[model samples]
Target: MVNCVVKNWQGEQSGETTLEMPVAKEENAEHIVHRALVRQLHNQRQGTASTKTRAEVRGGGRKPWRQKGTGRARAGSIRSPLWRGGGVIFGPKPKDYNLKMNRKERRLALRTAFISRVEDLIVVENFLDQLTAPKTKEVVNALTRWGIEPEQKVLLIVTDTTPDNLYLSVRNLPNVKLLRHDCLNIYDILYADKIVATSEAITKIQEVYCGE
Candidate 1:
């Protein structure tokens, strides 16, 4: 069991809450974490890098000149990759970068991430109601009052729907990302320097993934 300090809307320490760590299968933890990390990486990739190929580029419908009679090098079409303003050669194309992970692996990864939070002592009190809107200043002030650095990347995990104000306020902050309890990903957990979550989210994770 971990004892964490809860904070109120006024940024004052309210009280303490006790939570039990979920018991997870050690054998599956690593695999789950790996898959979740991979999934997150894949999701982040836009994979929108696209270039026009010879066939897709405009023009080149007719040969530029006679194949062997031209005073210059033999030319097949104007859209050749060697020509300027021509189609790209082996250029990147837009496509899906989504990667599929087994359900068990995903669950395991989430559990492992939670376990790490527990080990790191990063999980803190749920402060969902602390801010009414997406005000970066308010969020920064709250973190400052709690001794959390505003410059560091902070991941806030909410157990349920994050209020519009909370979402709006944190969206513009460079070092902050709003995540739901059920949406906890390994990449976010490991990438962030700190984790701030609501008590409800903590309990949900322990119940669903750790079976505490």
Candidate 2:
């Protein structure tokens, strides 16, 4: 369990909240989190890279020269790895890079990683109505009030019901990543310099992750 301060749109402390997600044990926290991160990154690879071997190359059926050459080395075929424009000796081929982890372990890793960033987590009250139009400047000003710098990377977590105007307002910021509560991932959680989650999103996170 962890306690967090909830700030309003103006960045004033309006209330407080708590997160009670189950995290991994301290002894195995790093290892489990690393495994989860690696699995996610590896699974995203397309694995389309391929190379031809000597046996698979075209025109390799006919030998290039006799076993005992006059002056040059004895060559088996023109597609030999040693020859120019020849097949590759050892090269990459298409393969699945996906890694598997149990659902319980994955959840544990996520909870642990999220909790570890408590100091950088900023919980704010839902201000969906604050944005009347899709203006990037308004979002920047709000972020500045929330103690986030212009150059810092921000991960803004919102509920599914959040208005499109708010999303439009935040989409133009290069350093800010807007994600729904249910779409949270290890990469975004760990990569952001600051995490700003709305109060309702925090509740949704607990309800989604803390329950069986």
For TM-score, the strongest prediction is 2
lDDT of each: 0.73, 0.89
TM-score of 2: 0.92
lDDT of 2 by residue, 20-104 (tens): 8889889999999999999999999999999999888888778777887478888878898898878998899999999999988
Residue 68 accuracy (lDDT) in model 1? 83
Residue pairs with clashing backbones, model 2: none
Residue-level lDDT tens digits of model 1 in 1-212: 67877666555777776766543467867766777788889988999999999999988898788878567989889889999989998889898999988776676666667666754334456566666556778878876776677677888877765468878877888898888777767777888877777667777767766642
Off by over 4 Å in 1: 1-31, 68-70, 119-138, 160-165, 168-172
